[model samples]
Target: MQDEPILKVVNLKKQYGPGCQWCSNGHESIFEKNRCLRCGTVYACNDLSFELYPGEILGVVGESGSGKSTMMKCLYFDEEVTSGAAYIGTYDDGETNVFQQSSQQKRHIRNTILGMVYQNPVLGLKMDFSSIGNIAEKMIAAGDRHVERMENRSKELLTHVHIPLARIKDEPKKFSGGMQQRVQIAKALSNQPPILLLDEVTTGLDLSVQASVLDLIKTIQQKFGISMIVVSHDLAVIRMLADRTIVMLDGKIIEQGLTDQILENPQHAYTQQLVYSLI
Candidate 1:
């Protein structure tokens, strides 16, 4: 049906070192209680779970080391999942687990079904490639080979992200930080994936630049009607982009609800502190 969630995750966990006595018994909250006091294992994500509905923006916010990035990495398949399942409803009729898919299948999903914009532009863009080349790379991966069509689509996306068409032939090295980020956004959307994942995309930009990027993201979401999972440490950024928000601490979700509900009446102690601290 039209109401089904686009992405669903259940009991997702990622940890370093094998679980020992400390992980099994000593800590009540593995994420908050980072160290396995006895074994010293790091719990990057502990039973993290949530659902992303179609055409909705779901924000994941928390401090550094809160595992927000880890969760994103796992979903994008950049980091291997230690355990648990994540299902993309539009993938294989929603019956198959994404993490269990073969490497080739994972690559196909990453190229065709998912688009990601990383916090560091370096991670998302090939700095040496021209803006057009960058977007074309994604199209080629999705099986498009006609040069004319690729160039046209690249130009369309570059214009969509507000990058001037005149610089389409220039490499990312020639662009400013915010401009580079815009290029990455265009490339990620070149294939028009059903779901997009953004990891602290506006973190290092100037305040004015941040505002523009945020505006572009909102515009793109409205234009494409795509589902998005946004990870950020900035509540303001999340507030602007998310319909529903989830607050993560250590490695687990501490609170979740509509964006307005969470900001206006935060229930969790950490969430209250985080929300007020921003004020």
Candidate 2:
């Protein structure tokens, strides 16, 4: 384990507005007029803190509505953090003012310092662009504006993802689901980021495909020395990848421990239920 952390999320909170699917606010009893933005009611994920060390894999797990996705949004700074600080490095640098940063600053951070793999590969890719172009887009954002750098980086990334160099010119529509996701992985790594966030990266794939993608992720994490946060409901995936596991419920962390410890001796009742079902 590295002594320094690559990403630190501290006391983080996210709330969605009324009409949102994930809202955790009070039942529609009081009927306040000015609800939060987006969903329209408060989808509160309050006061969560977690860290990811270099070359370490931290898994976030829970049932639906457990705030796993909410927490991820906060980490990536997608939804404005209503409060608290999420530091990308030097966990104690006291840079708690993410909202105050300009849009350019946020873009630079998201582009150069972090890589994220979404649950859906297609939604994250450009339907009009070829595979190589999609990966090169990341290079452009990260300041590798020259065409040669973009081309070289794209080819290298596709190679890293085990995609044939010939397929790099093809549209995503031409690839299998697993191959498309591997492209997503390649694009995420285009900037050579030290931190990667995988949110349900294997969702909708068959067991064999899931295993292959999992293996690819493990290989990349080892090769790059990047810190990773794996968020998934798949317990088997968590067991295989996570150095430590955090289990959430109703927008709060209910349990955390070594993956083995929690799997073998779950403390919280809900955690026990999760474990038994895995049996």
Candidate 3:
């Protein structure tokens, strides 16, 4: 069925500070309340679980410090998970938890199964590298050796992301913020990974630039049928890209459903506030 999940996560949590009796005994939402009054531990992310279906865009919406980005970090393996399991359907028949894999296996998963675009171009792209070289770098990490093939693929991806072929030789630092983000997108997709992780890709761009990048993302998803988990504080971005949406508060998912449903009829109080604030 088209609805089958391609990626699954369960009971994911990430915490800062050592666990103490107070941290364990507290009942308040860490995100809403800021910190555990007794233990001083902060829950950057807590008890996150979700499924991303094949060819579907899943949006995660929350305020800053709500652990949305931390969740993405966990999924991308950029940050260590405190405790949880994530499975990619294509990996070992979905039997192995990605968090439990060795560093080498994690690298393979990052290169071959998952692609991520960070909110900051500096975080995702090598600003000093030419656009073509940036994409080629990813290809090289994925075991690509044919220089000509990598170049061709880079050109095609650049065109897809609406960066001109003429600009392919330019370093990202020479481009506009939007253009730099586009280069990042092209680089992420260079290996044709099955799943993509986009973290606030439009955060710092002008409104028009943001729209264009969002459009490019939609087009790419349609063209490649890739599953994606898009993280952002902007409801507009989520509306434009996600079929299903999850509302996270403090480090936990409070509500989730179809994008229209979450926007139109949010059930959780936090979600209602988030939805209404956009009006």
Candidate 4:
């Protein structure tokens, strides 16, 4: 049996405030440090733990401000886990403690070993560059790569994500939301990473489009044998896609079981409340 998890997170935490340059609201001062979410103050993700096995589609569901996105970022090496440990052991001849890497080292590992699908499609693609060019830039950034290799790989990944071969030339704004999401998926797959972090991939889409995208994700998961972590707020989404489910609340896991087990017989009051509301 496999001993190590394809992805493992333990006691992770993250806090944000105005000083983040990359965040949409650049934290120029103490007052503007974090994004203007409800409280307009710094937000933190406290202790959380979970695991994803190869070819597994694991769903994480919770209320707003539940740290789902932050945890996803920790897994993807974007917002580094401020405390605790994240163990990512890849079967493709790789093993690393994600929290231990420096920012530069983590950046190098991102596209090659960890491909992330963000909640906001805009976050995954570059704005000024052409869609294809943006992808090539990511490939180059993955390992200081050559342009040609990045281009060819970009085309291949676009094809894999079911993007029209020709659409690669257009800028991202020209595409529909669902279509732009496809481009984001293509970009995430560009480096052939073994693990994929999907943060609310279906948010804001109509149910029909949401189903299609989820189907595509399921198909790719089967084809590539990649382990995936899907974070979402909808119970139905979790019910439909997850092999196993971890119900989280207040920054800690409350219950975990086969998807059916939790849905049919929830052990925790918080899990029951969510399940009841769904029914």
TM-score of each: 0.97, 0.88, 0.97, 0.84
Highest lDDT model number: 1
In model 4, which range of ten residues has the least summed lDDT? 26-35
lDDT of 4 by residue, 138-220 (tens): 77777646877778888887777677887788888887788778888888887778888888988998888898899989888
Worst 10 residues of 1 by lDDT: 26-35
Q: What is the C-alpha lDDT profile of model 2 across 1-279, one tens digit per residue?
A: 967666777777665643444234444444343244445565457568877777899999998777887777666667677777766663225354554577787788788877888888776688569999999888887778789878988998888888999888998888888998999999989888888889998989989999999999999988887888999998999999999999987667889989999999999999999999999
lDDT of 2 at 200: 92
Error of 1 at 251 (Å): 0.6
TM-score of 2: 0.88
Candidate 4 — what's its lDDT?
A: 0.77
Task: Give a tens-digit lDDT track for model 3, residues 167-256.
Answer: 899999999999988999999999999999999999989999999999999999999999999999999899989999999877888999
Give the C-alpha lDDT of model 3: 0.90
What TM-score, to 2 decimals, does candidate 4 have?
0.84
> Considering only N, C-alpha and C atoms within 3 Å, which residue pairs clash in candidate 1?
none
- Go through the candidates in order and give the clash count of each: 0, 8, 0, 5
Ranked by lDDT from best down, the candidates are 1, 3, 2, 4
